[model samples]
Target: MAQVGHESHGLTKLEEGFRYTKGISQIPVKSAMREGAQALESARLEALRGRPEALADLMYGGRMGNDEPGDGYKYRGRGYMQLTGKDNYRSAGEALGLDLVHHPDLAAKPENAARIATWYWQHNVSQNAREDVTKATRAVNGGTNGLADRESRNERWLQTLTPELMEQLAAGRIGRAVEPPAPATPARTAPNAAADGVLKAGEKGPAIETLQKSLHALGYTDGKDRALNPDGHFGASTKEAVQAFQRAHGLKDDGVAGPKTLDALKKAEQTPLLSNPAHPDHAMFKQAVGGLEKLGPQAGFKNHAELERAAATLTFEAKVGGLERIDHVALSTNGTGLFAVQGNLNDPGHHRAHVNKQQAGEQPLEQSTFQLQQDTQQRQKLEAQANPNQTQPPPTRAMG
Candidate 1:
């Protein structure tokens, strides 16, 4: 893995990735004595892992082909073990149930590399032909680059198989590369709300245009307003367009146009619906995350970031685990030199976030501010329930 990363010109962030060199996924370069192969020890492997080059090549080039292109880091050095090039991907994927063609990123991830490394050793590599090992490694580097010549590949393959090296490779330091498990999805939330067909005032933007196109494509509307509702609006015409789409798609007659409505509209339009990443609605992520449930550990993550290279942002302030009710929502925006609040809000996680922040020498943990926010939000909710006409107040956060 290290060799690949070093050779590939991975950035600092990429270098930190476990799938590449400089991370757990890297193959530890060992001492020359152990590199040539004899029964090796675990610690020996650990030490090898630190050196950029272990085998016969650190000084000149590590143990590469006996002829030229001798093993160093150019092609067949780390993780894919000896596999490289297009042919390597094709042959390896055949044995691994992976479509490496589209997902080349899979090779870099640590979990997959470990699984594939072992599988290759057990199933494909053997003692009968040391030469075949060389060819396999050579094929991986560049099928055409070395294979077209044929002569060099043949000579190298004969010397490539060193029993000691085979055993070392078999040690499983390089895990059998395989796809990682997926992340678990949060449960679906309450049904979503959308305006009914015949757009009202307010909702506007390219979104409305998108909706209009969807409605027209699905044959929901035959009018000229098919381009997009102008003047940044989801007007009466938009509402009617949605209704036309809904009825055509066979859905319940609610004025609001939601996901179901959008899908039908997109189908009608015959264009892909837009999914903006900058504003990820928690709803859309539900399905994909759910599918990832069986893949790996998730709860261990406590923040939106990993403080290092992580495949995905795993941290979200956990839902405030505990709550208490209060009669009044209040705030002291001036006291803490920040807008501070007091009242009930699920405040446990808020408390923890503050604690972690302070301990890490960041901003002081400000529970009081969060408390005020929670209070304000609660007050608003209460007013909404008590008198729908009332402008809702902000939520509060308890003091630190």
Candidate 2:
């Protein structure tokens, strides 16, 4: 009978109360209310038998007696955590500046329902010292009716809410703010960086062997029975492996180990294993696969999280097009000057575009810092990604 009123309640009324609990005691507001809502749902389901009238009567039976035929329906519980009875309706209405008594249906509105549920929790259960899940559940249920189910749902929600979001709830701050996971430490491959030049099909050397070993170690396979064998030769098998690695690590999928691709492979070797592989906010690995796309040509990202991920993985390298040579540009962690590239000064146009986009009054790369400066102090701090032990040359001029 209790299940009869399920249609009367909606998620809007329920979810909004997740952040409210102003007067509740020491327990974190979100945590407490989350349990409260889960417990209410459990009790509601348990009490549901068959008859709609009986369900309403069970929920509001204490307040609305047998004298009225439809009193239970008129003042039944409705909200994320369910606000019931005439007295609660009156108090909640007065507090929220709405006449819930005359129009009891208003309490079913998502916003009003959320406010009333939180108000009930802040006043009724705020004095309970026992923070045990069952104790909190009983505070709302009038008894520990669905303690087990409530605890289970509470845990599931806790895992879903990030600590940063929990902090906001604890502080009674409103709205949502998601923080990205911390980046893994940058890792480098074997020390043979001398032959770091671009490698294509048919290329053979220790560098090719090194690249093959990296792809196999990092679990990027060549679409065969297993990872490619680490022969010092770059063949079709090696190209397939390179492309797979590139796709996974947000790089261009050209299958050629260019300086940028080599840099990514080295950094990928260092990524730490994540606790929850399925976490929603895992770095957007496929953000610009098959090429840096908008993120490359010049280095930049959509947000701070992306920027940090890029900083930990990317390095500057000059590339040559059909007839013209493009200057290499890499951004610093602090959003400052690019690292000094070997042939950056040769292309005056590229140099001016990168060094000071805002000053030059030209459109810069997408999602990258446009202000360029030759800050000597900042350049002094820059270290080579390939060989962090050695210091690199300073940026002579800004590039776009």
Candidate 3:
């Protein structure tokens, strides 16, 4: 029942129409098409977008017993389990003693849909459904599409259909039983009640205002150009800012300021900003930020803060001798960068330089102010030498 509810979208949508916008077209293209054949060029996909029949033919034609012209649209998915294709319709019709192939639309009717879905489930997924939801999803969906929703629905159904609840419904005592309210008692508040509680959308309070202020201070902003307003209302902008903060901190990006998210936010608030000028490695940080800004989108960094975090990880490794000190950093446009470092600093004889692939915009380990200036000059010189036509900055003199 849970799987049926999920597949049918709470028993609302039972037919496959293939109606989709340009951006949404990619989803079906990836899910429906075979691997490696799923790479439909964007321009070509856009051309087919908003055209359901054409999309159906493109995706379903030449496969799944859809050899005849318009077979794709004729035998399109229908029913709770989305029984699709000419062969499937024929087989299901035979099993249910209905002429589904001749009357495919009949599969969309509630009673017939339920029958077809149950029959399909019994034949294909019932065995796996007893083991794992993921395996059951794979059996039915050909992939784990909407697996999370399926799992959630399964859990809800399990809770709601308990033996006790079933007995109440069977005895017709569901609405008849009403328990009296308990006598009033003194309320006790926990010390960290606000910190523990979740701050989700549609909520308004000083706690939400504090969260908004913290997000704003952490350099997180709404998707729009405007900054987040600490208005005590958890609106779309506040939720967006919270989601951004969560993403930056590697938390679940659900947009709700839950206990974990609130804890992370508190830690982030206490930690100094990556771009803080007073930091010891501020010069190198500034240079990396400048380079990333100059490269624009090609640097593949969302912001300087992300780059700083990645750099910090590498810096710690180098300091502990887990990795050799970085010699040169090369930024690439493909969301990855090359770090030229020695294979092992412990073995001086092994001068073999290793290339470590790091995310773009990551900097080398922290260096002294003088060393950073020299390294910057050397990097510019190397770039100029490689691309002779490109202008370069003059090399810096060694500090006395």
- All candidates' TM-scores? 0.18, 0.31, 0.44
lDDT of each residue in 164-222, candidate 1, tens digit only: 45665787533566445467588465221233443333355555665665544333331
The local lDDT score (0 to 100) that residue 207 gets in candidate 1 is 59
**lDDT (tens digit, per residue) of candidate 2 on 1-400:** 0111121222433311221111123122222244355553333333332234533443444453323665665676666566666777778888889898889888877777667766766766656523455666666666654343355445444545868677778987746555665886785553443465788765566888888887765545553313467767666567767876666555798889898888876655554321113422122212212123343634433334334323212211111111122234344454433332334445554421123211111111111111111122244456345566566466587687
* Minimal lDDT window, size 10, model 2: 364-373
Best by lDDT: 3
Clashing pairs in 3: none
Tens-place lDDT digits, model 3, residues 241-288: 777677655678999888898887776666444356665455444544
Question: Distance from true position, residue 54, model 2, in Å?
Answer: 5.4
Give the runs in model 2 whose Cα sits over 4 Å from its true position: 1-51, 62-69, 127-130, 168-400
Residue 126 lDDT in candidate 3: 68
Best-fitting candidate, scored by TM-score: 3
